[model samples]
Target: MPCLARWLVLLTLLSHSAAQENVGIGLDLSVGVEGVLPSLARPANASRIFHGIVFDAGSTGTRIHVYTFIQKDPAELPLLEKETFQSVKPGLSAYADTPETAGETVRQLLRVAKKAVPHVEWERTPVVLRATAGLRLLPPKKAQALLDEVEVAFEESPFFVPDNSVHIMNGTDEGILAWVTVNFLTGQLQAKTKKTVGTLDLGGASTQITFLPKFKKTIESAPPDHIARFDLLSTTYELYTHSYLGNGIKAARLTALGALGAEGLERKVFESSCLSRKFREDWSFGGLTYKISGIPDGSTGFTECYKEMLKVVKGVIHQPPELQDSNTFYAFSYYFDIAVEAGLIDERRGGMVKVQDYSIRAKEVCNKLSMYLATKPFLCMDITYITCLLKDGFGFKDETILKLTQKVNNVETSWALGAIFDYFQNIKIH
Candidate 1:
């Protein structure tokens, strides 16, 4: 083979090996189940069968998800972290009876997938299975046996460990290219069009936004990832993505009441939920800043600090180009204001939730703003908001946003680099 071809082969092999090490899941896969992220760097240029099958033995039902990645352009079209999920009802679904049933489910899903994408080389692809919060809830022996049966049924590997990357708490938010905030921002500018579509992605644990232009494709991966991009309707665009950790519903409630402190505090998390331990320190999201103020030392452990974060993020909410009406900024601002009047809001005692509440009282603010702020990171809320924002906030209009995005793309000023510099300043790295 030619040198270039040989080099490509070598890289793929290396990447595959890396995949073996990186096979961890994340919070968005399910609630109450801790997720392990993949150690493998997201594929950038090759097409492969990257499948994730999840089994959550829950009180409600068993949930399962099967996703495949056609890595023709791994960097451009990675199977999203979003696609890695599905639910199963053990009593209702045949797959719940025995390992045999689970295997059958896999076979059935594969069959359907084959029909959808005939080019898939299923025989060579590897399938992976991991259980959620329920896994540990069951006796260890039982969990292991079930996992073993699942491994056998699906002809896949199973993992029982939870490795939360970034911070040691509130896990989730691994390698999705959103952490390189500056690059993510610059990439957005490059993807500018006539108008801007704000995406508010509210996940089980985190939230993010991706402003896309006309020439946008669904970006599935970020390789070498100095920067990140977004994909919409198979169109890819560089975007300014902002992510907030511990911003999900459960956490919202937990933090609201000052339950989850910095230490020994699980936050409003279900054991199987990936957000519990991942969100706190997940710096991998570029252009995304994860801030919470529930810490005791006015830090990431208490609700008071989180109230301040509400203040800090007001800048983003009130940014140029027409801020979203339903954004949390106003709610937080109003909540804080109320607390001040009632003398119940104290930044020192986690008593500012009132101030945080009223600031975002716009009737359709959160609902409408989701049109353009949605990214896959924020889970269910993200979907609702993004869908709502697109329909309501922008009134389902993309022409103006697309054109504006294109204009931003044309004006390249290295925002990402500047962001990095700003990051350094914040940290006093000099």
Candidate 2:
């Protein structure tokens, strides 16, 4: 064949394969469903980049992003240009400190988004919308309210289908890690590092731990020097998952008022009541390290209170001793060895339940904690030291990860930033 003809054929084949890839649109938008933020919303300039809208609707504040991809179909030309809509409630703290206003605020923001972006396709391109993790935690009723508000804006947009075809995607730690491990081959934490075997997610409203196993990437690859290094080996997880449902501020507020009577505290006073009473009633405050009154003025005294509150929470959150005993170290280790020896890694899709390994690993972690940070092991380390280090390519201050946050509770890691970055990358293709 002629050289020109051959080159054209190869190029055509590549394009055909690329088109088959699943380049779906992703969306993330949230408004507080309860508390002071119920009426809050904000809008901002969005660009035509990816079919995504990543909203950082943390209790501290709200950020709206509506990124458009090259329209799959004609009619979305105007989105290529910048459009600015000011935030109705922009306080970063308000997203969390006062969630009651979140739903209302989000509704206000959506109105602005629709007004600023317009429903008609300016450039004649196909568009889609995606809502992510932050909004899913709302109660069914509250969630419906927020979704209803979005539906109004979605309906007005000609680009949106009556069926609300804009696919909604909320991220799970499992889904996030699946992408990370498969694509990035993120390997594993060094032995004794807190993040090995599982992930600890500490979000605005809740916290949870997810565990997986470490097997050879090739079923036959022998274990590496450190168990952490063995993460490069292919293993699976299905045993360790613990979520503190009412642990988040919103969850706390709802359950607390419901249990202790709604009048125990005013809207703003909810957190205080949690630290002193509601939290104490449920969790073991033995982990608490600071007192609110002892902190000086001008600083966020709440930060101090938050640390103590977390400690109090861990005291009471766990399985009965019987369940814990059933999940022993020897048991997990045995299962892991058998699975690897049996060449079951690929068959299971990394979803095996190494229930025993998860606990044994936890113990090994606690032992390492005593030596490295001079303290007992705590779940917070999963989010604190583990996720940040991986997301940032293992760049973080050991002082914060190992000592204050992990040991004394007077520390903060770049967890929110890490989550933001990870979430950002997943949704925005550009």
Candidate 3:
């Protein structure tokens, strides 16, 4: 073989070997990685361009965020240049029994990173995967088994794998990181007098609410765990944030239908008044298929649907008393998705919407389920859940204005970018 080809083969062999050696070794993220980051000497003439890969292992799907950054000055925070994104469906949790297949999905996504980042830069580009509510909802042993498989896939890749490259992210960190992403993208983080907007993200299995509280009383009144002191860009921010597990759109459906924790679901048919009375189907989530339907003899409308949704929302989530006083909030993910389906917001140029808009749309869709049956069977249930979640669950006023957005300045409005930024900050590259 040629010298270049032989060098490539040797690298592959070493990477595979390292992956095998690290199997089953867990890294507790609470402890800081003191000496794990690679110390590289940069040449004066070399370009300051670098890349970071973050796989957002979400409940609905697995998305890969390949971010490019340019360091204009060594003393300043690196600026995000561009981002490339792609996703695979059914999420990692769907592969609970097939952990190796979950690793295969990740490996396929790594191919996208390989194409996005230059081969010469692969060695230094750190690649990490942070599983969100999907894995968080899984049993501990099952979740760890999946993580172990993904960790091996990461180590076998050519990209730089950090000490804890694959693990389930806690709810608090998930909310705070998403807050960081939105604030950073909107330029709030760079401003001297930061008036940052709040963020509401509704995923498949969990929902998050985060904002920088202005009133001192709000901070004092909140639960101790809801407030976090996060340091980014040489500044510390005491932000109010929380991630409600099993409260996401899909998860809420199970909760409303009383199928979430019930055993022997495959043989039983869970009914919900939120759905169409004529509707019946098989819904699969987190590797289990469920038989669900609506009561044919019972009534179904927005009024009945809202009542069912409130059961999951009313006393479940803690309401931040001061959130109603906040001026602006950016709601995204499932919030944006459902709004588009209901024609409440534009798909491309996301617009500002009042909390009442969701209520109005929910009423319209729930009452007219037959019209949207072929296209969106769960439209009524989903919309109703959003309305109840915002108002009854989080205690937002109906008149409160929320900016529904999918992206800001061409980058996705998710936690992946914030995670990559946090990764670089912790490493402090020389």
Better of 2 and 3 by TM-score: 3
Q: Which regions of candidate 2 are displaced past 4 Å?
A: 1-50, 54-62, 67-139, 161-201, 208-212, 215-243, 249-312, 315-430
| Candidate 2 residue lDDT tens string, 1-430 | 3222322232222222223332221221131212111011223233223222333443223445443323222222211223232334332222333344545665556555555443433222222333333345434454454455445554454432323433333334323332232222122321222233334344434444333333333223312211121122122222233444344433333333332223323232222321222122222111111221111222222233233344435443542222222121111111222233233333223234332333334334423332322221132122222222112211222221111111001111212222322332222211
Q: Write the per-residue lDDT of candidate 1 for residues 1-430, one digit (tens) a residue.
A: 3222322332343234334444331112222212222223344443444432233232123434333334344223232222333344441122232545545544444444344322323432333333332232334554455555544545432221122100111111111222222232334323433343343333333344444323223223222221344332223445434444444332343333334333433233211111122333321111122342212222221122224234323322212233323221111111222233333445333231321232232222322323322232222222223223233332332222211111122211112222222221221110
Top-scoring candidate (lDDT): 3
Q: Give the TM-score of candidate 1.
A: 0.30
List model 3 lDDT by residue over 1-430, tens digit each.
Answer: 2222322222232233233444322222233333122122455444356678999999889999999876454334457899999999979999999999999999999999999999866776788999998888889999999999999999899988878878888888888888889988999877734699889999999999998888888889998888888665556788888899999999999999999988998689998887777889999988788999988888898999999999998778888888677568999999999999999988999999999999999999999878877789899999999999999999999999999999999999998888876665541211
Higher-ranked by TM-score: 1 or 2: 2
The 10-residue segment with the lowest total lDDT in model 1: 164-173
Query: Which candidate has the top score in TM-score?
Result: 3
Superposition TM-score, candidate 3 onto the true structure: 0.88
- Give every collision pair in model 3: none
